[model samples]
Target: MPWPSPPVVATGFPGAVAPVRVGRQGIYDRRRTLVAYELLFRNHGGASADLAEGAEQDHATSQVISATFGDFGVGQIAGDKPLFINLTRGFFTGELPIPFPPHQVVLELLENVEVDEEVMAGLRRLKDQGYRIAVDDFIGEPGRLPALGLADYVKIDVAAAGDAFDEVLALAREHSRDALVVVERIEDDALFARCLAAGADLFQGYGLQRPVTLEAVSLTPSQLVCLQLVRALTGTDVPIREIEDLVASDPALSLRVLKTVVSAATGTKNEITSLRQAIVMLGPQQLCSWVVLMLLGGVTGVDTESLTMVLARAAACARLAPAVADLAYTVGLLSGVASVLGMPEADLVDTTGVAGTVREALVQRHGPAGAALRAVLAYEEDEPCAITGTGHAVYEVSRAYLAALSDAMLTVGAVAGDS
Candidate 1:
């Protein structure tokens, strides 16, 4: 039941490889319910923003957007909640492109941005396209008065605003009747109560919840190739074989595409052995989303050993459970993603849209697919007793494991250009 490996083709596109990180801080409503997160730029795993201050603002903003939507995934980071991302002059003035859909994010215009007629015109255009604009770190400055009229959310820094906080809050309420006044830097219980009493719509600060730093390894393929594939997939009436051919060019992309499609198709009876089947089943829009994410996040930085183990587990699952090889393979492949990314397994499943029986197998290890995964895991740990309850004999499991190991090594070698 081992799936055939696609030929590894070099895209000849230059790509940057490095670790990416972003900071996330929750913004709560009056009742203290988490509503949105203000994504920040972080240079390291620490909570301090010092390192991020030294980096170019535009680069930092780009990193945050890419890391949130691309690497960590919006679903995994914020679930159904909208993200509040700070926009520099480049983004606000339309000098740079915002890759995300308007509905998924609230565009925050930083306090430093010069809000002129040109910028206001850009804001109007974005608003017309359904983007919600937020005026960040507002202090009722006369210079920024023009932006308040188009603002959907007006954020005020309590610590920075000092005594003007109340006045600015009132001004925000008066200028933008529909805007949600977000009070930031609420450092104490007293401050939180004060902001709540002042009719603040949302609250954020270190006292409420400190920012958490999230990091991920960049993929090896060039951004150009990933973007090219994304553009092709997004184009009208594109052939399925064309998209499949583009995906088959990269081994890592092919692996993820197959795993995602098979995992989501939990009820399908047919075995998805080729990239074309996966592309056809996933559809162009979904596949395009995956490629865009890959373009933004790059590939996972799973080491050779970790990737080989994941492939081996997938191969073993397929061999042990031929009746549901696709589902088993998906479970086995995705089982290592969380470990590699240092995220919760449930979060990974939710992020990837893995649902129904596949979700149960990955999260709770239920059913035959789960049993197969459990048996493989137990065999890996040399726990013969644990494998007994999985309805798989030790001898058969041993043979499957050995064969899968050999197959996995060859696959890994091929991907690594060692074969």
Candidate 2:
């Protein structure tokens, strides 16, 4: 299916490209190959935000939509794989627009969204429109049984279901006979074996692979310049001309700025030839984003593997928990700084002039951002249990890792080629 055009906002940029984060987890068929990915929204402190009601829910949903379709194109994140997106009551009832084409997305109905007559009717209309539906967090609750009839997929949280896992699994299979019964939260080989033995059609969890650890290192002068530029851009207001001067001061940074602008403006009639023009054309916010990416990729003394991992982790953190995009990105990026610089995390935190929350997250892994960092780290290290207390779901962390890996590979390739 042809991709839908991204929504444009007042900034003249696609509104969907606005700074929003999304997390995704892979769903695999019995054969163990990836078939689909369920996208999630990460709130402050690394927990999955309660996307059930009010404006906060709306904003979170919108951000996930924007990031998935805009900043990180669906193709880059999931390729031809269909995406599973959780829908709140507003989206389920058509009160909110479902911008995704039916063929490309599976509309997952959260368990909390009442499956009443009106919602059932809405589901019918949507199904006729070619949208597949999934019943999320299904534990065979009596009230949610109505949705099982229309569901194309029924997801059971193995951990939450506990002793009733088998019964609920059987119930989902019986009622939604045609629906694929997906057993999720498979944290270990034992759990995976149990689910597979129980006849799950699909599977997901940390048991498939473990997360890796990242070591520390040092930075070069040019990389330090890029960091300074990021600070300047994110800090007090600086004029476009002054920002141009900062870019001009570093030959490599200047080249990257020009190249990025030219690349983004591809197919335009005019060629961007200078630093000032490039900075102005890309705007400071975008410039900062690019520079931050560059810093992650350009660290001089860091190993290519290490840098790539850090970049991926940072990007994933931002994508997974966009409510704290700036802080999340920072934490993700700098989580490796102390190690890279061969210093302590506390020392790095103390010197960076970051917010107390940022410091706590960095030094102690406290608060929401800290929880987010912890989740990302846990996912990276393949420690599913570590994510439990952080308020993030195993799937959410997994999705962030997968998506970030894609992004990091691209960034690393671009930076390597440019260098």
**What are the per-residue Cα lDDT tens digits for candidate 2 across 376-401?**
77776667788877899887777677
Those runs of model 2 whose alpha carbons end farther than 4 Å from true positions after fitting are 1-18, 44-52, 209-419
Off by over 4 Å in 1: 1-22, 28-35, 50-59, 62-82, 89-104, 116-122, 141-143, 163-167, 189-200, 212-238, 241-329, 335-353, 359-419
C-alpha lDDT score of every prediction, in listed order = 0.71, 0.65
TM-score, prediction 2: 0.47
Error of 1 at 256 (Å): 8.0
- Can you give the lDDT of residue 70 in candidate 1? 49
